[model samples]
Target: MAKITFHGAAGTVTGSKYLIEAGQAKVLVDCGLFQGMKQLRLLNWKQLPFAASSVDAVVLTHAHIDHIGFLPRFVRDGFRRKVVCTPATKELAKLLLLDSAKNQKRDAAYLNRKHLTKHSPALPLYDVKDARRALHRLKAVARGEWHELSDPIWVRFHDAGHLLGSNMIEMEIRDRDPPLRLLFSGDVGRYDAPLYFDPSPPPPCDYLICESTYGDRDHPDEDVLEILAEKVNQAYARGGVMLFAAFAVGRSQQLIYLLQVLMHEGRIPKIPIFLDSPMAVDATRIFRTFSKDHDLSEGELAPPNSVLDGPNVELVREHNRSKQLNNVKGPAVIISSSGMMTGGRILFHLKRRLPDPKNTILLGGYMAAGTRGRDLQRGRPTIRIHGWDVPVRAAIDSVSGLSGHAGRSELLRWLKDLPKPKKTFITHGEPDSAESFAAALRDQYQFETVIPQLGESFELGE
Candidate 1:
């Protein structure tokens, strides 16, 4: 009988891995890292319940760290099969994984230098070499093509529109009497989000595993682009830099596009903008390469790109160049990564800019628990960085309706379009959020719904 297991992201918002076993083969989906709360972060060091080397193959739904961050460790532990993903996913995952490894190395060095722990010197979970080796295994597959992972199991990718190459995956385990069909929603993106096409319609399925990141709440009713323009104008008035803590991959690019749109409409004054994170710079290039994957009209993303290459956009990829941003006279905008301020160029930017009252720190996207972004969102008095507390004297703001994840109504709407599923598993959310979403699904449909626990298993072929 075919079976599936939830190894991670069962009751949490990050560390998403799902295992499927059928016809004498094992497949893992979304080998991700655990972020946020200390307990979850510690899991990155724990041994997997199953040997990584035993898995036959892995199919990734997207390139976000929370979705593909653990590939290096998995490769180091002996996973050798092809890492199947869309061509764009393959490109972006390499950039993100390499950056993650560098951050890991830097973090370990900083921890060791401080003698912060009672145990031996800190060590990175995976290094750049590991990341490179993992990238070597990535096998690019085009969207909408069914790739055979095992003799009887086949998988296909449909655009999720959360990012350039994000996908909603469908798998058919042919060993079952009726060829049991299973669907995995990989962080469904917002409907009609700019720079991304709307998520594709959900296909028919016997069972569905879906994300519930924003389950109980809805975004405030407001025009997001107008709000963004107003925030930029506020930052301009300060005559100091506006620091944005953004994820290098999706959020950073979204902000860039939106800023360009505002500029074209003459909503905000022309101000120099710097994309200061190396990863964000690389991701921008990758995004440009995948123009066909987005919803841009013909010639819309043509040469001299109007979106990213607006009048005064700068790409800072070097350490020295990034440092120069601190010295640059402001009334400008600087977007840096390690979104949530976990670690990266954003820290340096924050340290230099957070002490001034004239600077505005715009927190973009969802800030996971235990992250500096979350603290900022809660309006904390001070932000701790590198073992020092920086008083939060700067203006703090967030632009709602910019999140990449789908909202409650959107998720329900996605489900509403499909035929009733035999079973539904709600995941990729906090316990409360997942449970709340599951209850709502039950109220709206007759499908048997559940909020699976970590390592929980279910037999799909009965």
Candidate 2:
């Protein structure tokens, strides 16, 4: 029997790690960092319950920090094995890991300089050197092809349609009769979503592990173009900078394209649109490089007529330019990263703009619990940032239909056609979300489901 363990993303939406063991071979599905609450974030620093050296390989789902952020630390902890992923994921992972290291170092230095951190030195978890070391081990394999992880075990990738090169993992173990099959739904994507293809239909399997990020809710049934146009016009009318806290990889590119479409259609006047995250600038380029493989049309990614390369769009890469955005005036849009306001340049923008009534802070996507973005979404009076409780005077608005994760109904749709598995483990969400999805499956399809707890283990087949 093969044993599977939930190391992260078991009871929360962030930090996604799973370990699968078969005899002498051990394969980790994803090595992600825990984010959001201090309790979860603290887990990132704790020694992994299992020996890092014991794991033979790490197979990635995508390049999102929450899903693939802990590689440097894992390497530091003595994991000296191939980190496998799709070709596009390999490119994005390098960019993200390097940026993650830089961001940690910068944040740590800032905390130390201001005497804000409890740790005397306030060092980064792992530095750029560590990140580089981890990158050396990354090996890219194309989608739809089987690659052996070790003896008695093989794996394949299928497009998840979540991000630039996201995928779901399928693993086949040779020990069992008919070969025990397992599928890992790596952050299922929304159907008919812009810029990416719909998630591939799940193939038959004995067991399935799925994400429940939006398990309890469905996205609003509204046109994203209409909602975005309205939000943009309102922000412009207020005569202040319209700040968007977006995920650099996907949401930032999507917003730029939609905004460009609005201007082209004369729905909203042409305005200065600045992408203020250096990592975002790089990621956008990577998106262009692989645009042909995605669902975006030629004009959406190609230069000259490219949606992301509109006349009013500006890519801010230098640190000085990002800082200058703090002084940006009204009738302008500045998009920054760390989507949930956990870290990155978004903090500086929030501190400068959150107290201005004329400014509008648009939350473009999901905001995990304990994040400053969640506080803003809930209309909290004050947000504690960098040791200060910044008052919330800005108009807080959110646009639905932009989240990358599949919602309750969509998740059901993704699984409805597949044969019932021996068991389905609902994970990668908050406790309530996991439980609610589990209940829905039982009621609607009578599928056996389990809400795995952190560090929980299970035997797949006899």
Candidate 3:
């Protein structure tokens, strides 16, 4: 018999981990980090529910930070097994994990230096050395092939369309007369999103685990291009700065692509766009390298050069150069990372620009609770960050269509072809969203649905 456990992302939108044990073999799917809420972020400091050394392997579904950020910590605690993922995901994970470690180390140092930490000396969750060690364990597996693990356990990756190399994980424990199959939806990507292919139909499964980030809500019925042009033009006409908080991985690339296309079509005039966050600059190169992942055809506007050549996008890397951007008082667009405004250079930009009523803050994706992005979306008067509460005077807005994760309708469309599993566990959303979606699955589709609690476990029965 095989049992599954939800270690994280059970009742929240971040820190995704699912432990599956079949027979004598134990493996984890998506070792991720808890983000947004400080209480959740502190959970990263706690010991993992399962022994790191006991798991035979980790099958990574993709390379988004929320999906794979805890890897360095897991590896540091003696996980010696192979880290399996797609080739593109492996490459991107290296960039993301190292960047995460680097940022954490810097944060810890800043906290210790300022005497802001409770500990005598603050320490990062995992250092660059640990990230590199985790990178060393990555074993790239091609999509669509059933890779064997133990005697009766096997797994496969399907196109998820969420990010450059995202996939839907399918694991089968071939023990009983008909092997018990399990499907894990790794941030189901929307169909026809810019710079990416549509999510593929899932393979058959006896059980299903899926995300509900946008399960209870549908995206606003507005043309994203029109909205972008209006916002950009508004910022430009007012001679004000336009700041964007975007995810370094999927959301960053999507924003750049949209800007490129908008410029090409003359929908919006090209402005001086600054691509802050070194991780985003690096991720753009990877997106260009993996051209086949996107929906672009031959000679369609690609990333890197596409964004650089057309939009006059400048890469902000050096500390001094980034600092200079704070003095940028013009009709320009500044794109920064850490989408939820949790931490990163985005904080610096928000601090400098939030008080300016003329400026605009464009949020690109879903912001979890306790994040500054969510606060801005909720029209908070001020956002507290790093011991400072910055007053919000900037015009805060969000473009719904640019989100990498699928909304309610698209998620249901993805579920259309799926075989009626014996049970469906809805996770990776807030409690209300998860419970609502669970009810929807049960009422509308007649599927046996469950909203798993954090640390909840269930045995797969035949």
> What lDDT score belongs to each candidate, Candidate 1 first?
0.88, 0.89, 0.87
How far out, in Å, is residue 55 in model 1? 0.4
lDDT of 3 by residue, 1-462 (tens): 899999988998889999999888988999999998789989999998778999898998899888899999999998999989999999899899999999999999988988888987989999999999999999999999999866578999999988888899999998787788999999998777777789999888889998999989888777777787787888787778999999888787777777777777777777888989788888878877787676753125644345345538888889889999998887888999789887899999999999999999998778899989999999999988778889999888778888888988888889987779999999999988888888888887898998888899999975
Could you give candidate 1's per-residue lDDT for residues 1-462 as a string of tens digits?
888999889889999999999878999999999999889999989999999989999999999999999999999999999889999999999899998999999989888899865558889999999999999999999888889998688999999979889999999988756788999999898876877888899999999999999987767766778889889998899899899988898888888887877776688988899999888888888988887766543123324344578659998888999988889778999999888899998998999999999999998677899999999999999999988999999999998767888888889988897888889999999988888889989898766798999989998857
Q: Which residue pairs show backbone clashes in model 1?
A: none
Point to the candidate with the largest lDDT: 2
Candidate 2: which stretches are off by over 4 Å? 297-307
- The predictions' CA RMSDs to the true structure, in order, are 1.7, 1.5, 1.7
lDDT of 3: 0.87
TM-score of 3: 0.97
Error of 2 at 159 (Å): 0.8
Candidate 3: regions farther than 4 A off: 297-307
